[model samples]
Target: MKAMTFKAFAVVNEIDLNKIAIHCGIPKKFTWEEPLILKGAILESILGREINAGQMVLIFSFGSVVFINQTEPSETTILLKFIQRFEPDVEINNADRYTDDYKLHIHENESLELADEYVMVPEFEEFYPELISTVLAKSVALEKTEEQLGKIHDRLETMIDRLEKGKLRIGNKELARTTAKILRHEYNTLAYIMILDKPEITWSSSTASEFYDKMMEFFELSDRYKILKSKTEILYNIMDGFSTISHSIRGLFVEWVIVLLILFEIVLTLLQIAGLLP
Candidate 1:
């Protein structure tokens, strides 16, 4: 069986594909829906590696790059450094922190089979790399988002603990910051990463569509996205509850201040009536 390995990384918020294309002097071949394909001599020159047959790199605008049949960690490090030129804020460390690996095997007389572990195909098509990269890129992106959500969840739990102890304290500024963080995450995952949207290629080709569906199921992408949405809603409700409590606390404090000022005025009036004040 002829096999190839694929690795994908979600390293940054986004990549400047136009800038990279300008730098490479390669004509812009990528769109928001399609990833830029690098193969043959130019890819070799970029990676500073030998040109192996069937080796390719796919760069996505959503801050993901898939390395097909390129296994070396040093190769990834080198390419990410090059990529950092286009996106100065690109954190190379995330390449390791958020990544997914998949394998493709071509077997004679075998039908296309996709599973969480690997995919087996009768023959590789020109579109296989793009399709596979799409799945891998989103999968790793989801992984990163999942990690982020986990952190938020843990923080909420900490707040809950404080509440249980009757010591919950959060300022309006902190609440605003937290709300913005959650909203940003929701927008990034839904609008930016677009895990729910179908790839454009899949719309034109039924076979590709079928393959993409199978790959999505294999990765459980939709289900995970739903879970993320549900978690977001729960967090929202929690924050809403906190907001209500905060407002109520502030209102009570204001009322107490008003009552104390009234009492002070009454006391002064009583003293004046008794000739205790000039």
Candidate 2:
């Protein structure tokens, strides 16, 4: 029997976990343990297949849903359609296929070279969704961060143009405030992806760790992680610059107020000396 695995992922903002469980028709007892991983048997009919071929649905709190099936890649189409039935507002969708071979003696990296071929293992099936989900979540996070950066760049460009023309007004300050808020939200999203949403190492299982490490390398996850880190740092620097500029503007306004007060006092003293004021 030729075993094959197909994985599909969808990026969403937030999925009500309980709602999804209920929507999938998972029994309340089975869901109480780990609501994230839903077995295929419970959804087989709804998914329109005998998931005994191997199926698992993993939902991440970071807003990613991964469906893994050990059947033909074509079979996944129905599953994907079924998921979309519940979640109509998916932001991004991606799919990957791998053929499983038991006879082939393939190293982890070599398996990647085959591209869509993988060595069959029970542990791999258990952990595969986490790997795929991590990658998908990271991709989504990067996309979101880049979008925020783009908006900040646009606003910054406008602010720079106004400043160059010596027409920086109260609106500029408001823009800076808005940008800061966006930056904060973006930073939080990045943190969630990098820290909270990452896949944890299964210390007890060295095989699982090796698989994760190899797969991460195969996916160039480290490189992507570095890029995300660099982008986050750039955003932090920009936010810092905004803060400095805001403080400088406030200082300038304070100085003008102080000078005006001083001039008013001098005028009042002169009027009193001239017997023109009480």
- Which candidate achieves the best TM-score against the true structure? 1
Candidate 1 lDDT at 213 equals 90
TM-score for all predictions? 0.92, 0.66
Q: 22 in model 1: Cα distance from truth in Å? A: 2.0
In model 2, what is the error at residue 125, expressed in angstroms?
Answer: 6.1
lDDT of 2 by residue, 151-185 (tens): 76676667667767876453565756866766565
RMSD in angstroms between candidate 1 and the native structure over all alpha carbons: 1.9
Top-lDDT candidate index = 1
| Predicted candidate 1 versus true structure: per-residue lDDT over 1-278, tens digit per residue | 46888999988868778778877778765667677778888788888768678888888888888999885778888888988988888788757888888898888799988777689999877677788899899888888788888888888888788888996567889889888889978976766778878888889999889988989888899999999999999999999998988888889989999999999999999999999986
Model 1 residue pairs with clashes: none
Regions of model 1 farther than 4 Å from truth: 29-31
